[model samples]
Target chain A: MPVRLYLSHVGKSFTMHLQGGTTIPVVSGVDFSVGEGECVVLGGPSGAGKSSILKMIYGNYRCDQGQILVTVGDEIVNVADSEPRKILQLRKDVIGYVSQFLRVIPRVPAVEVVAEPLILQGADEGKALARARDLLTRLNVPERLWGLPPATFSGGEQQRVNIARGFIAHYPLLLLDEPTASLDAANRAVVVELVAEKKQDGVAMVGILHDQDVRDRISDRIVDVTAFRAEAA
Target chain B: MTDFFSDDPLLQVNGVTRYYGDRIGCRNVSFQLWPGEVLAIVGESGSGKTTLLNCLSTRLAPTAGAIEYRMRDGAMRNLYQLGEAERRLLMRTDWGFVHQNAADGLRMTVSAGANVGERLMAVGDRHYGHIRETATDWLGRVEIEADRIDDDPRSFSGGMRQRLQIARNLVTHPRLVFMDEPTGGLDVSVQARLLDLLRRLVADLGLSVVIVTHDLAVARLLSHRIMVMRHGEVIETGLTDQVLDDPREPYTQLLVSSILQV
Candidate 1:
């Protein structure tokens, strides 16, 4: 299978500019290649920088060294050091991210939050809203909460909204951070089924999931992140 | 025919033809729909799929031909041959038709709950509380907010309205359903998700569906069997997988391979 994401000798460090430019290193010499239709999970305890690895791939955090190449259509992009505009473009076109938190403008409804990705990509507003409603419903988020923003929603409800927003786009490389964390068992099963469907559609996924059952069921392989803990400078 | 019943086919459509003045809408179509089977009738615009669907579902009278429906009593009754009241009863209880536009199928001014419960009320379910409860349950089943059951369907968006229409039709547990481009106007993602929901409902309810759509993808996703129609005539008929994977007819192959520009 053709490789969709290739991370070679990746290294990241946080430099405190005020503290004599000292560097706190995380994720040094990390190498992995995720093929199309494969899901490589980041597995480790807290503070192991799994989220940072995702951020690096998403171009939210800069890598100090090595290549974070991603293929979109026929183009291979080095996401680690891509231009800011190109990174933004990639976020819109090639990469989809679902974090553990729900972040939306205050007073914006859940439907719009989930629909924004498609709307931003020049899809019709009515069509986008319809698709968003379907995703939110499938995630088991009550219909009453759809018109309400996540600010007033419960933790599980917000998480489901977050999840619905994430899977609304068709991205080749999807980065999921604890997708089913706050969901109930039934809703979690819904997400599991959705992930299985996406896998069958051949989307390359990288996820950080604490739930062992979902993690084992979805991942093609586990990338241990215990060695990537950001140490004190 | 006795052959259809012995094999348990739910509906037999034979030699169905329709004419709109000098223009022929459709001509000489025949097929059998079995229980739990989804049969998609695919054709280009004005290719007579809608006309055929209308004829089979009793929305329009065919100029010449007969549609035989297997009644709940396990008897073969010609749909067009039935009395007005009997046809209406069959439409209400035995079959469902999902329109492309939800507005045509729904009561615009009434609450979504009322729209869903209207069928139950028509079928002589008198208890107000049971009807309301059932409406709420159906709304939940279609992923509508139970709280919004009191709100009118006009207040909802297109996808929500389409889903509500589906709930209203399916809540009565109709043995057969006729869908006219159920996901036509929706976005790609919306279409995908709605297809998933429809697949789930069909499986759960053991529904027999005769859906008319120009979209080959829709046919591929839902239909057990597919009958390709063109120029108001049946061109090819086979299992959906076989027909889609290896189409024998040139017209069908072109239709299948034609890129969906939508």
Candidate 2:
């Protein structure tokens, strides 16, 4: 399998003005990558710019310098250098992201949440709904909860729903930040096994987690951001 | 263990049940926190671990139970029976809250110093200099660098923010503390460091704590007594070392087995 997500000399930073016009850089130079069917875990202390890497991979933030190359199926594209139109298409068709905070649209049913990615990618309503139901069942979300809104569910259930949304369409690359943080040992094992199952289906993943158990369960490669920073220093 | 509980428990909860409309939060949940002891509540999400903490800390009203607090005035008062003003007074003087997300428990807009000092200010410590000194002192105790006292919490990393939140809660010198997964968002190394800090703080302050977490290792590291909850009921409860080493419950055994330590 080839590399699905690649970053070479990736550096992301934001400038902040201080009391007397002094500026501070938030995220310094950082580099990492992931391949098809591979799971990478990024670990670091808080404020070490871990979340920034995910955002950059998902096209939410543009890097100050360096490039991010994402290859899926027959296409290879530079995420950082891509035009806005191409970036939108790339995110819509190939890249999927589950944020640290499970941001479900309030009052929207879980079925709708899962199916929205397909709907956004221009799939027919019936086909998308069927796909969403299948994904939810595979992810172990109860059938009765399908039409119910995410807010009615507990933290762990909501996280499962979030994962379902990102995986329902079988997008080539998946980015998850603390996806299993709310789950207990039993449920976390199920989710980790599910991620492995998805990887066997050729879905690539990069997850950020503080839980070493979750990290050990899902990761093929571990990237220590704090250690990387220290070596760079 | 008897010598540990020689003095009366600082906080006693009995037959507690909390509900939201038709939904049950917890039922017949009972526990006691003696001074200088750590009691960990381990449960999956929706197991009512957090609700139990809320009821004990008087943050949530229990529909069917009583939380008796041995007050400084040498009188025992049921927390649920207290009036709003009385609850407010109790909150200011006796208890502290550390939420799962440090950002939720902290005022992110404020500097770290002000965040810690807010507790002192709440309890009527009006002297700015005194508040600053106390805040700096507690921050250092929690292993947060003192030079970052004036930095906004937004600038701190996840681990540092959690430490700052713990410092904020501990600064008030509350006899009883409640923490909901204080290390949930931190990396493993940071979690170990924070656990070490908490162990030291619990020993030094002699503060009784009810910490809610889903991680068994966290329970092993910080707790003396462990309660395993499932579906809003206590499935098992025992000494941390004993229960974790030899879990009797099938669910607990399953939970223990799923952990693949490297």
Candidate 3:
């Protein structure tokens, strides 16, 4: 197995216009790599830029310096430099992100939110929805709520939906930012099992997590975002 | 739960029917809502989810059946039992709304603080200093900076504007809130933060909410129960996890499958 996602000397800074255009640097000169079937955990205190690094990898935030590269099959793409269409295509197939919350189209059912990806990839809608149900069930989302929209769901329930949506697609690379932040201990265990299964399937993952147990269970290596935090400071 | 009126539902909707000219808006819709509960309505466009919501909110008159709501005084009365003026006042005092567009829910010309304080004012708060202080506190809770208090919502970003709108509607501490795709158009990052905030506020306040959205994730995070509608009728209704995990209905199965994953 080779490196699926690579980062070297990554840096990011925020221009706070409110603070009289003060440029506040957060991450600087961070380096890491995630290989096939490997899980690299970014562990550190809050505000240490663990999420910023993950954001840079997912192309949500731009890195000021260094390479944030991802290998989609054999082609290596710099997430920071990719075009919008290229990033979207990569997002659709290669790289997946499970952020803290579940963002979705209103009035859609829980099953459709999870199953829609497969349907777009040409899978039968019925089959896709059924598979979505399987994931939701495994994650412990209520059976009755499948038909309802999720706007009224609990924080923990919402996070499960985000997890289901992220895991529904088979990607070469995955990013998890406190994926279990809102989950209780019981649900957290389910996510741990899911991550293990994903690892066995050869999907490489990089996650920013504070839960020491989950981090210990999933990490093949630990990248201390504190290292970058120190540099930025 | 008290055995006396223990089964007394907070809202009892029976055989409600709504029509749009010759078109059926929704037919024979019936459900019960409890205190401190959230209910989500889900369906594709023209599936009658919107029509069903309109009827429940009394935005549209139902052609048949009855909708009963339990007032704060614990009296169950038919919706039309009250005068038109009383119904309008009840909507203002007891219910809150968060629309798909922040502009629709907020006074864009007003300051962010004023937008939140207006709800308090509506309920008869006259102390200018107290209202301002409370407004500032809510702004902080919603992750809005104090500096933005004097700024108008029209100049704010989409996420900020939406947050301001939520603060406004919540100021009066309404028991029931009606939201139509509250996080529909925001970016994923923004939407996540908003959902977390909403969950906290709802729990802290013990609010009952009737929300209509197409997104299953929102329902799962915020509601205890869910109702699935298709073509103006509820095809399935159950506990959030149960319905999503083990859908018994065919239409529900398609809906579960219809979600587009990121």
Candidate 4:
């Protein structure tokens, strides 16, 4: 299988400039590679730096050291050191991230939110909306809520809307951060089926699934993050 | 990734700085606006977002820095270096500025039809019949009734007047539009409708716009990228969602959080 994403010796930490410049180390020497059509789960307890690794891969957080290389067509770009513009371009064309919460844009319909990514990629408006409607239906979002903004939806409803939006567009490498955290059994099963479809399409996925059943079913390999724990000085 | 329709920016501002007698109005601001893209300048009042917008539109000159615009002839010219007559011609033909106060942008003494037709006249359209026909078409496009075309803007309500201002500006098919709080004075429901109309027209016309607004919601709905200003300097700039969702700067984070949630 072709490797879609690779990270080696990756490290990250936070500095409290207000608190006398104290450096708090988070993770170090994190090494992993996810191949096409494979779903790799980051397994560990809380505070094990799983989310940070995902953010680094998505170029949301700047990694302190080593490489976070993403395969884009024939080019390999390092997210850790690339310019902000390059990372933004990579995000639009290569990576897709589904964060835990949905950042709602006011007055935009829920269906438009899901259809926006496809539209930004130059898909026809009618076809994008059709696909968005299809995903929203599959995820069991109430039909009445599709035309309204997701801001007022309950936590679980919002999560499903976020999932529908995330899964609407096809990305070669998708990063999932607690995507199913608020979903119930039926919707969680839908997500699992969605993951299977992505794998069949040869997408490489890295996710943090705390739900053991879902994790066990989808993960081809588990990269335990405890080994990458950074020691305090 | 490769745009076949000319990757060159439509407007470029390099280190633009303005001073109001030693106190900075805006300082060292720089960014590029591509064709068919909307860039929002967002900050609290006194943050110099207005100053930057004025400088970009040539309504106000900067103390330092250059503002270059790509003309319809495909030549880049420094706005400050252009002659007064040429600048006026560009303002009437290629550029449009929508003020926060509708009265400021419109002629209260003239009928809404005349308000929209005046720009056509400025650009050398001589046929009165064709100009009035186009004016009526634009009034309808902005959701104002065609019957309202003959009424003066002073007789219209605030929202109607604002919509008329937009029609007047857009009637010329300007490539770039500068909006300063275009939805500022309207009611919530009215603002939503106007924003919907503006979004459609912007997309349909493929306009490049630089809009200054204190409302983050307006910024999110209209802009592709956002530049957050603080004390006359750009504090942080990024993709609109990235800046709003995961702001890196503490000030930006506070601004995003301060938005009233329902």
Candidate 5:
């Protein structure tokens, strides 16, 4: 399989400017790659920088040193050093990320929230909403709740909505951050099926899944995050 | 949709800085706004977001730096270098500024039809029948009753007046619009309604918007990218979701975390 995402010697550390510039190193020398149709799980304990690695890959967090390359239609763009505009363009056209929580514009209905990714991609509004409704149905989100904002939904329902939104668009690379954290058994199974579908579509996925059953079922490889943990001086 | 002009930015601001005597209004702010993109300037009170907005809209002169806008004729002209008449024409035909107060943007004493029709007149529309018909159509589009077209803005509710202001500005089909706290002082439900309307209209019009607001929710709803101002300087700028979800700057992180999650 072709590599869709590759990270070489990626590192991250936070500086506490308010605390007299105290530096806290999070992760260092991180290296991983996800191939098309492959799902790689970042496995480690809490605070092991799994989420940080994911954010770095998504361009939400800037890496200190290294190349985070994403293949876009024959061109390989490095996320670590790309301009903000380029990162935004890459996000719109290439990457899809589902964080642990669903953060959306207040009062935007759940269906619109799910449809927004596709709409941003310039898909027709009617078809985008139809696809959103289909995803919501597949995720077991109540039909009535589709018209309501996900903010009012239960934790599990909101996660499902988030999942639907993330999966609504066709992105070459998808990042899943605790996607099934709040899901029930049935919903979790649905997420597993969604992962299988993405794999069938030849998407490259990197996820931080704590649910061992879901992780074991979906992960083609487990990258131990603790090996990249930066030691405190 | 062609490759030639599609990649050209609609507006470009290079190192725009403004000062109120010894104090900084905004310092060295710069960004490019592409067509059909909405960029939000966000910060706490007194962060110079409004000052930046005013400078971008040509309402206030900057102490330094230049703003260049791509005209309908496809020539990039420095806003400061334009003749007064040309600037006024651009304001009337290609640009719109929606103030925080509807009264500031509207003629409160005039009937809503006149308020909307006045913009048409500014752009050389003279036929009374056509102007009134267009005004009535706009009122319907903004969710105001067609019969309310004859009512003056002062007689309308705050939200209605604001919507009227929007209709008046959009009547000429301006390609670029600058909004300053467009939903600042409305009830939550009312704000939601207005936001929904604004979002739809912006998308439909393919407008390039520069919106200044302290409300992060408003910024999130209306903007594609966000520039966070602090102490008269842009502390952080990025795609809206990336900045809001995982802010890199400490101040930005504080601002994002401080929002009451009710």
Candidate 6:
């Protein structure tokens, strides 16, 4: 039950030049948190700044005002004012992000995609390959297709490879952008179960989702971003 | 397998068998999709739902089967028999496909409007203004804000990109729209809204659709009939209500029961 992340009064804005030259408020005074091993589901209408919040959490975009305090273990790091390099380091070693669009490495087999993070993190090549293979096997990305590049795989198979990549590293904080959007029923269930299983290992997850049924199956805490947007307006 | 017929079968899969060196993808998979009807193909990841769609779209050649399409001039055509030029023509004019990932169906670097209007340009509609208007109309039909049409699809949220992809396909108003997990990447509220938009658009346009999804909830919401596949084969095919409510097969029962409603 330890605190893993905390964002207080986060405000992001943009300066828009009108006929009279004025500024517009895009997001104002948003706040939420995730604890160690807890999942916070963020849902809202399109353009409600759902992805923006993820960007803020991952330190991609800077907040104009307020503080974002992220707890890595016991120490609380103030991300609002932290240097970009510091944040980058934090993400590389501790944060695992799965974008909605799969970023495939051309000419690399599906199994190698999952192992890339591990290889980057300095894990032994053989060991990393072994773990990646196990993860793909568990997620049901067929063994025969492991050698084939993800470019040839179907939408669901590509997504499975992406999931394997995100979870293979086993970072404490996993930020997923619609991880199971294209999967068939069986693959979707496997993803839900996989996340639920990982939660037992004390990983904190924040994901943007459109599937309420899938959300209910895995989430313990749901943060409705639409409500936040309405309040801001 | 039981036999059935539709008034105008745009997609006719007869004795379709696909295998990868003896690992079965699907066997004797047969179905008929008529005009204006939404037939859903439901299965898990390995169930071969996508394989069937790929074979029909001619993205992948079936090992042993024939995919026949009834053309506009009261003539039946075999899609596989066509050469590269003819196949490309079918993709441009006769068929539309919306992949689960919006990026798959769309060019991320281009504006949303261009992504929707590419098919138009491919078929020789070079008027920029007309293409823009049509793109805007389809975007509005899918409930995306018209103002964002000029923005690169790379900047759009997942749900918005998906809507744009649907708009991109439907702007051509093709006879058959094959959707693979159209709402798979969205959250529940987003999914509900997207499903509502799809239902309204499908009803209004009478667009024939074949959707592949793992979500039975989606099947119940949008499909007129459902086809359940397991391990690359169709196990059950019936009306959505009948199959979902009273599945005759054990695998179907498991899939139905596993749905955790929010």
The fnat of each candidate, in order, is 0.00, 0.00, 0.00, 0.06, 0.33, 0.00
> Candidate 5: lDDT of A140?
90
lDDT of 6 by residue, A1-233 (tens): 88777778887754332213334455667788898889998877878878777776776555667888877766778867765334544665677888646655345678877897887566899999999999898889889999987877887778888888888886788887888786778878888887887799888889887787888888888887765552323
Candidate 5 Cα misplacement greater than 4 A, ranges: B1-6, B246-254
What digit string (tens of lDDT, one per residue) describes model 4 on residues B61-143?
Answer: 99999999999999999999999999999999999999999999999999999999999999889999999999999999998
What DockQ, on C-alphas, does every prediction get? Answer: 0.01, 0.01, 0.02, 0.23, 0.36, 0.01
Off by over 4 Å in 6: A1-233, B1-6
For B32-92, candidate 1 gives per-residue lDDT tens digits of 7877778899989988999999998999999998899899999999987899999998888
Q: In lDDT terms, which candidate is top?
A: 5
Pairs that collide in candidate 1 are none
Q: If you superpose only chain B onto the true chain B, what TM-score does each candidate give?
A: 0.96, 0.94, 0.94, 0.98, 0.98, 0.94
Docking category of candidate 2? incorrect
> Using DockQ as the measure, which candidate wins?
5
lDDT (tens digit, per residue) of candidate 5 on B1-262: 1111267888999999999999999999999988888899999999999999999988999999999999988999999999999999999889999989999999989999999999999989999999999999999999999999888998999999999999999999999999999998998988988998999899888888999998888888888889999999999998786788767788887788789988
Chain A TM-score for predicted structure 3? 0.95
Candidate 6 chain B least-lDDT 10 residues:
B1-10
Q: List the residue pairs that clash in candidate 2.
A: A46-B157, A46-B158, A47-B157
True contacts kept of 5: 0.33
- Give me candidate 5's interface root-mean-square deviation: 4.0
Show the colliding residue pairs in model 4. Answer: none
Cα lDDT tens digits for candidate 2, A136-205: 8877889999999786688777888887787667678888888777677766776787788779978888
TM-scores for every predicted model: 0.53, 0.52, 0.54, 0.87, 0.93, 0.52
lDDT by residue (tens digit), candidate 5, A102-131: 875667899999998898888999999999
DockQ winner between candidates 4 and 6: 4
Q: After aligning candidate 6 to the native by TM-score, how far in Å is the CA of B152 from where it should be?
A: 0.3
> Which regions of candidate 3 deviate over 4 angstroms?
A1-233, B1-6
